[model samples]
Target: MRQLVRAAHIGPSLAVVALATLLAIADGLPAQRVLLVALAVLAGQLSVGWSNDLLDEARDRAVGRSDKPLASDAVARRTVLVACVLAVVAVVALSFACGWAAGAVHLAAVASAWGYNLGVKSTVWSWAPYAFSFGGLVVFVSLADSPPQWPPWWLPVVGALLGVAAHLLNVLPDLDDDERTGVRGLPHRLGARLIPRVAAAVLLAATLLLALGAGIGHPASLVGLAVVVVLTAAVLLGRGRVPFVAAVLIALTDVVLLLAAT
Candidate 1:
């Protein structure tokens, strides 16, 4: 049971729900609608998380990854695999409860994640899942309204770029392990040292685009952008924890701006 919980990647899944809920609240969704959308997001994320651990069980074991419950034999692969299947069902059902268009978009996000686990994670297109999954999320939440409205143009763009940045950061610490396991995504093609800079640059681009798309009168966003620039510069000058810290800082800035813009 403990291992099963661990395999769910609860922290990240909850973060997804939190973000989706924030979007729902920003859009003034009814409490029931917000809950439904949040539930759907949670289920999809659970499927993604479980499937990732199940698919990577062998590779993780190969790399002796103690952090992975499956790799460490703390959870049976079959158990996690079953959870993935069940969560996927919940995702589909709950998504349709939101509406057809919203359901389709959320399902595409979930499918993109499964596609990544099934084969795409090893290809150059590894970034696609993150982009679509995240991009679709805001769209899904926005559409949960009684009369759905299109999300602003900047919403999905920032989401996609953040997705790319996340992919880079996530793969960085595991580059060597992933290489050993025969995983060669875009980050691999870019090499280790360059991944940090690229990730920072993408995040920086997201902030600038958000600020520009929303107009310049908002000094708060401009201040956030400035903070991102400083963090990016610091990351470029150093190594180790700086990149991760910078990513977190930029993400926090993004959350504030995202709520404001949406």
Candidate 2:
């Protein structure tokens, strides 16, 4: 069970689910609806994470990725495959329970992620899925409201920029392993040294967008922007895992400020 959980990429899956929960709270969704949204997001993320491991089994094994349960032979491939199938079914049902509009938007985000895991991760368009998925997430939540309206245009753009920053940061550590396995995604092509700089810049843009969207005149907006600038500076200058950690802090700051402003 533990191995299976790990193979599902529990950390990232839980992180996404947590974000969904926060968004649900921020959107003032009812208790039942918030539960449904959490479940749907959880299922969708599990499917994405599991399918990613399954698809990359060969590449992960080739690169000696013992951290990956499937690649490390800690769990049976068939087991994870079945789990992924179940998650897909659950996601579909739960998403629609939220409403047609929200369901469609959420499913699109999940499909974009699946697209990434399928093959786009190896292409220059690797960043595209992240952009679509994260932006779609915000829209999905907004559509869940009774009126089913779109979020402010800038919110989606902020989400997209954050998504891109996430992708660049995520790919940084695996550049060598990915290159060895012939996975030459955009970040890999950019090489390691440049990725942190790009990620910092992307994150900075996202921060600026959020601040502007929240109204620069707001004290919270100014404070949030200043904090993000400091964090992004750390992302650019910090070494080892420091940059990744700082980026996560920046993301959290952005989300909190977004909720407060909205």
Candidate 3:
């Protein structure tokens, strides 16, 4: 059980579930539908987590990253593989239970990540998967409404841009190891000095779009603006872990703004 828990990367999965559930609630979805969407999100995030670990098992072992359950041999590779398949199946089934349109969007989101796991993560277009996946997620959740709603156009824009920033920040700490393992991606091409700058710029762009969508005088817009300025400053000027942590906090701020907008 503990091994399975580790294989599932429950911490991140829980975060996804929490965020999706909150979004559903913010959309005023019925409790039943909220539960369904949350379940689907949980399954999709699980698939992403397990597939990520499984696909990178060889590299994790090579890098001696024993903190990973697969690398430590605390979880069997076949077991993790089976869990991944099951989670994918669950995501498809539960997403469709919401609605056909919602299902398709959610599936595409998960598939984008799958594409990344397959090979896209090594390419210059690595940000594609993250953008599509995250943007499609907002679309999927909004589509779960009874009459089917579309979020503000800028919502998906913010989502996609933040997704790209996330990709950059995520790769920062592992840049050296990823290079050694032959994984370049977009962040690698930019190098360390420019990655944070790019992330800060993207985050600022996302917040600006949100401000325009939400109205400059709106409280949510004001808060997002403030967060954007502080975080962008930290990313551009701070060294060590400050930039990465700031980027994560900025993403959280976006999530809060999203919920407020809904």
Question: How well does candidate 2 match the true structure, expressed as C-alpha RMSD?
Answer: 1.5
Per-residue CA lDDT of candidate 1, range 1-262, in tens?
A: 8778889888878888899999999999999999999999999989988988888888999999999999998888788888889998999999999999999999998899889889898999999998888888888888888898888888988888877887887778889999999999999999877887888888888899889877766887788888888988877887777767777677778777878887
Root-mean-square deviation of every model: 1.4, 1.5, 1.5
* Top model number, TM-score: 1
The CA root-mean-square deviation of candidate 1, after full C-alpha superposition on the true structure, stands at 1.4
lDDT of 2 by residue, 88-131 (tens): 99999999988999999999999999999989999999999999
Clashes of each: 0, 0, 0
The segments of candidate 3 whose C-alpha lies over 4 angstroms from its true place after superposition are none
What range of 10 consecutive residues in model 2 has the weakest lDDT sum? 253-262
TM-score of each: 0.95, 0.95, 0.95
Residue pairs in collision within model 3: none
Q: Give the alpha-carbon lDDT of every model.
A: 0.87, 0.87, 0.87
